[model samples]
Target: MVASIHPSLFDRMVKLRRDLHRHPELSREEHRTTDRLVSELERLGLECQRPLDTGLVAEIPGASDAPTVAIRADIDALPIHEETGLPYASDVPGVMHACGHDAHAAMLVGAAELLMSRPEPPPAPIRLIFQPAEELGIGARSMIEAGVLDGVGAIFGGHVDRHYPTGTVVAVSGPVNASTDGFRISISGQQGHAARPHETVDAVVAGSLIVMAVQTIVSREIDPTHPSVVSIGRFEAGTASNVIAGTAVLSGTIRAQEPAVRAHLHRSISRICESVGQLHEADIQLEIEEGTPPLVNQGPMVEVARRAASEALGPERVRTMVRGANMGGEDFSWYLQEVPGCYVRLGARLADSAGYPAHSSRFQIDEAVLPAGAAWLAEVAVQGGRELATGMVDDLEAAGRAS
Candidate 1:
């Protein structure tokens, strides 16, 4: 029978999660939170190194010299004001851990505690990555730039989802999330009086036309089989009622799962905006800010995660996802871009906490999943270490070639 996680580790995880939820900080600004994590990891006797502006890497040496396995937890919170009525709600106004990074951080720390308690180290070294600025989608990249994965063989992480019960975990092989990119359009025209229709190029009208035309790019230009999203979420124009605004700005985002689709979306958005500007006789300016890439999990690594989750919880509580890629993007994708890795979703919902989404001030996760998450991470480390030691990646590649 699989051993149950210690009771003390479960209690510690709950307390740490609550404390982090209460004193949340924003992206790239997690000073106090970083300090607390450093202390906890050090107490567990892991070799620690702080590389990024507000992040740290803790190394747990194993019994052998196999490739290192890294597990990441984002520590940054969001800018939302707290609305949750819990007694341990965010003490800092205008800042909240509504996205559940606090829970991730606490869970990884609990995993460190459990792993450190074994009589000897496991087969391979374990890297505990406390990443900052994940909400801005740069933490993983920053960590990579700092050589966090210099010798790492694989990585794993999990996000909290309210769609499932607290004991459940959802994961799958291949692309799980989409690439997110942002765009801004500036339309310039001649300002004129509202009553004088023919004298000047009204930017408000031109911008409206451009907005309506932009929608056709997705509906008309792209292939129907490939999923894509282009949302003009924000628009700005005239201030006074009598005068037509000289300029208008439109800002939105693009999301796609495949690289070819992502490139097509970016190219099409620019082409559509420029075409609309020429058609409306307005000077158009376009800017695209690229975000994270799609997270594609390696098939073998995904099986390891599935087994770990099933070992910690019951088999019924662990599932392989069947749905297509999610539009939401993650910085963890940065790590996957360079190495073979798999990221999972841990359910944090209780029966009473339905209808609330992440990043809202009212967001709260079921704390009962704390032990389950920690136990799964520990199991993944154990299994992944063994796989790396046995040359799993090479064997899998050879089998793919033979098949």
Candidate 2:
């Protein structure tokens, strides 16, 4: 099933995304981006609110006072230099929509246009949320604090993944994305000359041992079939080659599909750091910063998204992802925690390039997927709202009869 939105509206969506790409903003600094979105959403005659300085919400009322269903698009860009070299490439230095948020924002606006164009308004309320700071992983939380999900029964979101073929859409039923947690380890040892290394406990050596042991948490401690990753991305120690540094810092991230696995990994990481320091007779300090939890798609919500996908794109284009829960985290998980929702991956693989992952300077998306993404979201909101309202009415009536 292909989307039946007007061609002119589709063209407008493409142009809007391109314009956003050229003038990308970063994280909480999305003033101009929010301005453009507010203008478009207001033009569609929806009620708009800019609760966060950079994020905004727009509502489209339906036929009744049914619960709201929210559809979100992250508006923030990344601090990456553009190498795609397109004419509409980012004009701002060190700022670009390398993660396809430009596309997400524009598509949601397109969805707003389509939903408003209906001859008769939707059956239940719909909210279009333009969130900022997704790159920093705080936008969704900020919006939630601002009550974007108030009175809403369900939510829907998507990310552009270049790994999938253009026009392909994927949404998994269980844990579709991993929980992201970060840790920092500091080891303090006696400073001494490199020539007399035996005199110093060698904090660098201790930190290295901790990093190596942390890897065993995923390989041995966790089930082999369960998805998990412990990567030591940063290690810093001596300033000069001749002297052993007094302290070393090691920082990395933990990713896992299950909450139990995440907890186990964190516990093991702490144990490894402390054990390594004891063995080397060095003082150790561990700091772990908790991040978003794994996004587990509610079974019913995934079914709704799957149906919407088949309706907006052809059934053949709607794929069920069986493997590869993205280790990257999304704050959208915050919304899912409050209500049932589904987050999908909209394929943005360019026609010419093989496969370039997001956050890379060369990241690009196939422009053709814009309408499909937008239409799918708008349709899902309308349909999902109706389902939720019907369920609520049925339960209320049952209660009244029992009374």
Candidate 3:
């Protein structure tokens, strides 16, 4: 059941992907990207709506007003200098589509083209979400607040994965990605000369102790079976070697697959900070900022996505994540919190090069995945729409029987 896309369409998508790669935009600043997407989508006669400042939503009309099936693609780049040195490398310094968002956006546009080329309206409406600020993990929430999901019953989205071959698709049920939250700890202590260190409470020593103690939260406190991480990415203190530092600051991220583990991580960190502060007789403060939640794919939605993948690309091409669940964070999880959805990893691994991870400067994708990804997105929308419409019929019949 491998659907064939026109060669010309694939060529156009490749061109579009290259164009976007050359002019990569950072989060919340995708005005030009938004304009380009609008132009291409409108060319297909789809109505576009600006639900936010940077990102926009486009809709393909259907035969009936059944709940819309949404397909999402993030349209933001990372703050990395391009080193691929391709002719179409990013023109903007310190900003590149190292995460393959350029590919995601172009594939979505390709999907729109395929859907619009169909002879008849689909079984239900389809919404294409070109989201912004995904790297900061705030785009989905903003779009949701702007009512993008008003009529959307089920959503489907995917990221390009370099770990698998280009022809494969990973659609698995259960937690696929971890929740990402940030924390900051500040310590204030008395300062004194090195010769009189006894009179001063050393903030550097206290902060170091706190950092080491926090590691035990994952290793000792939380269940080892449950994957969790507490990493201190930044630690700052002291001005001169001779003086006992009076202040220190620690900042890092917390990640966990389960909500219970996430909460436990926060509590344990706060406790460690307080205990260390009291022991050192210093003022220590801990601040936790919440980010995206864990992305757990619903079983029914996963089935829909798998069916779509099997139909669009052969069943042999469909696969699950060979490595276990990913600890990385994705903002698409926010949508699943409100509606049923599946977030998949589309294989875009390069055959020649040992692939670089998503946030690396040297990362590249197999361009062949563009058409396959577009096909999957299109088929998933159709499959999801049919499933949702059938469920609606089942509900109506059940209600009629009850009456």
- In Å, residue 30's CA in model 2 sits off its true spot by 0.7
RMSD of 1: 3.2
Give the alpha carbon lDDT tens digit for every residue of 1-403 in model 2. Answer: 1356688887888899999999999999999999998888878887789999998999888887788989999999998999989999999999999989999999999989988888988878898899999888788888898888899988999988777776778977878788888888889999999999989989888888887788788888899888999999999998899999879998989998888889999899888877887899999999989888888887588888888888878788888774578888888988998999899998777767645678988888887778888888987898888888898899899999999
Q: How many backbone clashes does candidate 3 have?
A: 0
Q: Write the per-residue lDDT of candidate 1 for residues 138-181, one digit (tens) a residue.
A: 98999999999988988888988777777678878877788888
Clashing pairs in 1: none
TM-score of each: 0.92, 0.95, 0.97
Root mean square deviation (Cα) for candidate 2: 1.7
**Model 1, CA-based lDDT:** 0.85
- Measured with C-alpha atoms, the lDDT of residue 252 in candidate 3 is 100
Point out the higher-scoring one by lDDT: 2 or 3.
3
How well does model 2 score by local distance difference test?
A: 0.87
RMSD of 3: 1.4
